[model samples]
Target: MQPIGWVLLILAIILIIIIIKNFQIVPQSHAYVIERLGAYKTTWSTGLHLKIPFIERIAKRVSLKEQVVDFPPQPVITRDNVTMQIDTVVYFYITDPKLYAYGVENPIAAIENLTATTLRNIIGDLELDNTLTSRDVINTKIQVILDEATDAWGIKVKRVELKNILPPREIQAAMEKQMKAERERRAKILDAEGDKRSQILVSEGLKESAILKADAIKESKIREAQGEAEAIMTVQKAYADSLKMLNEASPTDKVIALKSLEAFEKAADGRATKIIIPSEIQSMATLAATLKEMVSDKNIDISPKSEQQAQTTETNS
Candidate 1:
């Protein structure tokens, strides 16, 4: 190769290197802080940017997206002098790349220190119980303070959270025991309430059964009384019908006397110590005995004798 050709090739390679170094493509959600002549120049956003190769350079690449930082546990004392270890997580984003590059030497380290200091200040005013319970209050206070303080550094604190608050080992064990006891008590109370409800349901069912049974018994008694009354009415109606039939017959006196005799015969069949006979029945019985004697004698005339006895009975009456 010729020397002139070699020199031309080296110049072409140097030019390519300068072009590659000077031109930059900033990615999305990122900003490049540029410094020219050892001073802040401008911030390059998400686009192609050109800079003088040696005079202007990227000082820092600041992410514009929201970011998370998990700080280590910081030991703090409560108002009651109880020492605890608490860790924090911060959500932040850069608002200005120039300020982020020139505002502070180390923005993350400054934020960590600020978080620890603010946590101590808030926890120191509360007792052990309050410090354990009031995590939200502490988080809000820390977030407000950090946001105000980091504004100069082009950082906006979106939120602060206490990742963990670990108390002493003995206190943790005691809290676990208390929680277990409370759970057991709730279980017992629930069981007792269930038993009470079951008993009440059982008693109500029994009471309803008893009432139904009583109602059935009452209905049965009413049915029995109705049956007895119906039987009595039937018997009385039968007696009334018999009397009406007898009255409609319009019997003669002889037929009436025969009927009376049949009644007397029926009464005589019973085991009565004494029986009273009416005077009319006695006269009829005497007349029947006389007629029977005359018929057996064969010498007495029945028609004339019967006429003479009837005349005598009528005159005597």
Candidate 2:
């Protein structure tokens, strides 16, 4: 082959290589920053893009997907002068590829430094206790600060988290002891409350039992009184029934007198300080005694008269 033909073939090969190099395929969730003659030109999104070889070049390939960065532990001093190691995790994403490429020299290093500085500032304002307890507040403050600071760099700080906050070994031991003591105190209080509840329940049960016993005693007394009342009524009814039958029979005065005597005998059988007999009863008693004496004298005199009469009649005959 001739020298000019070989030179032409070499130029064609170089041109083909340049064209292939100029073609770019931006992948999903990715961006490409283009620079024209060392100056910012444009940003290419996810798709095929062409750039003039040797004139326009890709300055940076930015990933638009959310990313995570865990910074190393930083030594921080609290307001109370307690030193501790705190590590942070930041979640971020690229919002603008052009700005992220040209806005800062080392964006990741800038973010790490900013995070450290912000953490120190926040820790400086809080005591050890507050620093341990206020994780959410610290995280929110850091996120807000980082978002505002990184906005010009085309990065959006989605979230910031304190991954770990490690206190001194001595302080950790002391905290463990304090937590143990607090738990024991709570346990004692709970036990006391349980005992108090048990005592109250027992007292209530005893009170209820006493009330039931009193009610039972009261019911028994009421029943006993009712029984005595019924018995008295039965005795009175029997006496009334006997009196009614005697009246129905229409007894003579003598019989009534005898009944009265029987009633007086019954009254005498009972305990009494005095006994006052009625005038009718006194007259009946006196008549009974006089009749008894007259009958006795009649009997004695008849026997004697009969004997004397018999003797006198025989003498006269």
Candidate 3:
């Protein structure tokens, strides 16, 4: 072939190659910033995209999906003048591709520097102990500051986190000791409270026992006094009733003597073996005279026949 024809053929092949390269297949969560005439232009959303051969170019590619980046440990000073090392992580994504590509020279470096400065500013206001403990607060503050700063760069900071806050070994040891001492103090207080309660219960029981004893003593005294009064009343009533019965007089003296003599004869009839009548029986008219004459001669003896005759004579008289 002629040289001119060969140059034309090569030119055609180069053009075809350029067109094929310009045909870009963007993923579901990605975007492409397009530039026209070496200046800022529009961005293409996800899917197949086309670009002008050389006049329009894909200057930058931005990811619409969230991305995670880890930061190395950084030394920070707290308000209490305590220094600690903190490791962090950040989640971010591009919302506006045009600004992300054209607004900042280096978007990632800018975002990282802004995050570090904001973290220092926020943490400087907190105490060392709080900074070590309050991860949620730190994360929220960091996210808010980062979002505000990165907005112009078309990056939205979804979240920020302090992965770890490491205090000095001496501070950690002191904290552990303080916690242990607090627990021991609580235990001692509880023990003292329990002991006091036990003592109070014992005292109450003793008091109750004493009250019961006193009550029993009081009741016994009342019962004894009542019994004494009842005994005195019973004795007095008996004496009064006996005096009233005695007030009703008996019969005449003759009748009393006769009944007394009859009772004495009946008693003696069952007890004595023999009886003797005095020779002067007519002289013995009173009971005392009769008794005295019958017993005056204790040695007098009589035969069984004489005793029987005397008994018959007495019966006849």
- Top candidate on lDDT is 2
Model 2, span 281-308: residue lDDT tens = 4346554454335334333111112332
Per residue, candidate 3 scores C-alpha lDDT tens digits across 272-309 of 54555433332336965655443343332333234334
Ranking by lDDT: 2, 1, 3
Candidate 1 structure quality by residue, lDDT tens digits, 1-317: 99999999999999899988899999999999889999988888999999997899898998999999999999999999889999999999999888888899999999999999999999999999998788899899999999999999999999999999999999999989999999999999999999999999999999999999999999999999999999999999998998788889988888777776566446444544333444454457664674445334433222223432332111110
Runs of candidate 1 with Cα error greater than 4 angstroms are 1-6, 208-317
**Residue pairs with backbone atoms closer than 3 Å in model 3 (clashes):** none
Candidate 3, which ten residues in sequence have the lowest lDDT sum? Answer: 308-317
Query: Which segments of model 2 are wrong by more than 4 Å?
Result: 1-67, 241-251, 285-317
Better of 2 and 3 by lDDT: 2
Misplaced by over 4 Å in model 3 are: 1-7, 176-317
Q: What's the CA error at residue 20 for candidate 3, in Å?
A: 2.0
TM-score of every prediction relative to native = 0.67, 0.68, 0.54
TM-score for predicted model 3 compared with the true structure: 0.54
